[model samples]
Target chain A: MSTPTHEMWTARLRGAWQRNLPIEKLLPDDQPAYVVSWIYVFGVATIAALGVIIASGVVLAFQGPAWYHTSDIGNFTNSMHFWSVQMFFAFMVIHLWGKFWMAAWRGNRVRTWITGAVAFVVSIATAFTGYLVQTNFDSQWISFEAKDGFNSMGVGAWFTVTNLGQMLLLHVAFLPLILGVLTLVHVLMVRRRGVVPPIDAVPGNMEVHK
Target chain B: MTGWLASFLDHPATYLKWGWFQISISNLIVILIMLALFAAAILIKFPKGRE
Candidate 1:
């Protein structure tokens, strides 16, 4: 059998794209009438926090990891970045917990829930890598401590914290890319399923479980 | 912007002077201001669980 030519591959890919689902089918512009509460903001809040984290991370990148460790300006930017990361994790955990208590996995949303949970797990790993990249006193302590933990768990056989080159690559590239992909998948699943409806339709006193 | 604002807080006429400190100070101030704005938005947007 002959290998597929570039033109054939491109044509097949375009056909797949044409067959792909539309965004509107995934998520409707008009939400259910019962979705009128501030609790929903947790998801958006997490996204916003991530926005800040990315922006701070970008600036810190431009300043370079070495500069961040040594220079005064870079130091402050690094601190801001650290705090942003903390906030990002905080918001994500809250959002995930909130969704769980709300039984957001109901109906056809099990896939969405699973995707979200996987994304959350990846995000935690990303944050852990970020801490390793810090290379501060905290980073040193965490490195040794976490290295031991992972070693005990047999994960250290593959991943090493002391390898600066590997850690840098994972921090600046791999972890982020993994998190980004998982987040994208989670979002697609959520949009496809649409937001889960609140339990009752009463406007004045309808209560949804935590 | 934040760094400049902070430096300007210390020396208001530093713009008349050239310093490598400008970028740092300016970015710091911008970060601070943006943080405050975001905090305010959060408060307003999520007020009493109206999310």
Candidate 2:
């Protein structure tokens, strides 16, 4: 009692999905068992560090540039934020390096790696903008100094580092928006692909190649 | 009011006052340098095929 139309439609749908995606490889629920190591924490750690940075950054933003110099709590909060940012960037660099060393970009993930690298560059630029928004003496110095470098590169007129308004908007709104989107894409790709197994994971391939 | 901002700004550069948890700029720079060297050491020691 199998209906030919239903079976034919199902076959066509399956073919379409297979044509659009390599369904044989990117199964939704399959992953290597070796992915259960403490080494996996580095990625989570980097994400947590970014969370701390954003929390601290919000407090700093609410207080504004004058508060860091005027209020005691503001100063302390600002210091915590500054330190958190430094730590966040440091951990992110490590996490990125670990992924690179493991060659996690292999298989169907080459585009993901390139997109992530672009995100890293953008994040660093966002951080530099945050520094300029501080408007403290250090911020002033870095701003003018960085402006000269940008001018020499011929993009200073377009970016205009002297404008605090523009810098603030970019830091709080634009860059964070870009970061959020990129992070979503990166996480989705990771979830879809799952963790890649180590090269020496085979039952008979465990012999050290080096 | 102006004097207070100036004084507060200068104080961070002088005697450390933010308790044990507080990190000084010099100490931060040293820790950063150590971290960089540590990462480099890992890269050198681990090499490519060994890890």
Candidate 3:
């Protein structure tokens, strides 16, 4: 007798998921000893900074622009958000540089590298939208200056940088959603693939006690 | 001295301009710090975990 359609589909999906990503690989107790490098810490640092950025941003969002502009607590939260973004970019750039030198795309990890690179590009757009929604003179100047650039690129019609409401929505909602999803996928890919071995080391055979 | 420091803090960021190239001192400092951190990350020895 043939299996029921729904049961077949569920079985296929479950089988694929378990076959591709076993629990042990997803959360391994021991990493390869070659993973003992300070450079590897930058990726975690970037994620930590992102956590702080999101926390402080949520606080700033609850308080209105005027509150952030005037109130001491609001100003402090805004500063936290700003500085966290700086840290995020700094650590991410360092992480990217380290990964590049390591040739981290080896061992069928090209998608992981691609997702990270695309996330960086999307982050720049997210940051640009952030600058546009700051509700300050700097934002004002930036919007006016950026509008011409967007227009020249022939995208100003849809991406109206000068429109504060639209820019705010993009900054707080659309761009962040994409960035968050990309980050999740990139990290999951890393866990599934395991860390890349050193350039000269043979994979799975060069375990050193570090 | 206090007044001068306050004035300096309140004023616009000082920029270093060389022809078409220009950068604020604050931004330059951040860049330099990032470079230093990157170099340190590469050079510094990582701790060995339990054998």
The residue-by-residue lDDT of candidate 1 on A1-210, one tens digit each, is 776675588877877654554656564555554455555666777777777877888888787868988888888888788887766766666666557667898877888888778878878887888888776787888888888887888988689986667787888888888877877787776666667775554456544322
How accurate locally is residue A94 in candidate 2, as Cα lDDT from 0 to 100?
71
- lDDT against true structure, model 2: 0.72
Model 3 chain A lDDT-worst window of ten: A201-210
What lDDT tens digits, residue by residue, belong to model 2 across residues B1-51? 368877765664533457666666766776677467446635444323322
Model 3: per-residue lDDT, tens digit, A109-193? 9999999999999999998889889999999999999999999999999989999999999999999999999999999899989
Residue by residue across B1-51, what tens digits does model 1's lDDT show?
A: 378767656753323235654445555665566556445533455323222
Candidate 3 at A54: error in angstroms?
A: 0.9
By descending TM-score, how would the candidates be arranged?
3, 1, 2
lDDT agreement with native, every candidate: 0.71, 0.72, 0.90
Worst 10-residue lDDT window for candidate 1 chain A reads A201-210
C-alpha RMSD values across all candidates: 11.9, 9.6, 2.6
The 10 consecutive residues of candidate 3 chain B with the worst lDDT sum are B1-10
Give the range of the ten consecutive residues with the poorest summed lDDT in model 2 chain A. A24-33
Ranking by DockQ: 3, 2, 1
- Best candidate (score: lDDT): 3
**How does residue A127 of candidate 1 score in lDDT?**
80
Q: Estimate the TM-score of every prediction.
A: 0.68, 0.68, 0.91
Q: Which regions of candidate 2 are displaced past 4 Å?
A: A1-32, A203-210, B1-51
